[model samples]
Target: MTPPETQGQGSNAATPGASPAVSLCVSTLQHRPDFLRAASALRQGTGGFLLQARDRRDDSPATRVGFTASKKIGNAVARNRAKRRLREIARAVLPGMARPGWDYVLVAKPGVTTIRDFALLLADLQGALARIHKP
Candidate 1:
């Protein structure tokens, strides 16, 4: 697959002059049942976010991810901002960390979801995924 178009910082494409890693085919988990499945699977919480991941033992060749922010996080704008930050971090990190045929959900926490430093948030996510996937 040609690299996905970059909107800004978290571009899906590999940087120039670097050989690309295995391309990721990630899908969005939109159905309620999908999210429910992830909710019942392995979970890891970091300082920045909560991650839930499940093996979707089906024939699909792509990993799926979902994002959610509770109403208590804030009003619509704040919730959206938190979700957007989660999405960007997923875009940048999931290709490297996520396994195919798994469903992952990212739930935004209250204060750190939006205001935390991006690099730290990325590290938190990477750490969470590592812990979740460990044998």
Candidate 2:
């Protein structure tokens, strides 16, 4: 599919000339201070509607993915791993399967995402998105 209009840096969809990739996952998220604002924007932009027959906000323009890792995961190294894992999942799963608009947030869970298998991480992301995107 064609890329969406660019609205500045906020426009993080896959670039046309570049190889296919999820420009950014959890598109609607911002710094923690902006979480409420981001959520509000996503809620409105996606039309306050959900698409999944499971009623999981499936019709929404952007699907949201969150990540959060606690201290037990390890020190900074571990945390980074978690973030990397989340990013990889975002990279692999979001480009083709996602609906037109989606907000994918990768919260850090100490060091979770970093340690997971690449294929499994990707599959997990797909499962999450599929549950919410349209049929």
Candidate 3:
């Protein structure tokens, strides 16, 4: 994930094409193992540099997003919590912070999902996205 400071930048202009509002959200890791595997292999394409306001893709119509959490976070409970937290973030910011044809992979930070304040977590994630997805 990008640092929280940058999330706000991407929060705008992230409409149906470049906005987060139109991005797809998937919470269940089991629903798409193939996609999970593919996502795991993803290197930082454009290193989040592609989202920059200056270099941002002007023609893209959608964004693709993926998430990953390893066994290190904890048992099923811990992992699930992390994903849940991330889900909330995607639901909150993705709708308003991303562009179309964007594929985002929200990797779980250590103990991230375990945090009880989901709203805070979501804000942090949004802020980070804004920072990372900058021009």
Best by TM-score: 1
The sequence of per-residue lDDT tens digits that candidate 1 reaches over residues 18-65 is 666544898888999888878998999999999999988888879999
- What tens digits encode model 2's per-residue C-alpha lDDT throughout 1-135? 967666654457555586655454335344664443334442211111111211234465555544445577678777667766665666666667765544445444333355556776666666655655536
Question: Which parts of model 1 are misplaced by more than 4 Å?
Answer: 1-23
What's the candidate order when arranged by decreasing TM-score?
A: 1, 3, 2
How many clashes in each candidate?
0, 27, 43
Residue 17's lDDT within candidate 3 is: 52
Q: Between 1 and 3, whose lDDT is larger?
A: 1
Reference-based lDDT, each prediction? 0.90, 0.50, 0.54
lDDT of 2: 0.50
Instruction: Quote the lDDT for 90 in model 1.
Output: 94
Better candidate number, 2 or 3, judged by TM-score:
3
TM-score attained by model 2 = 0.51
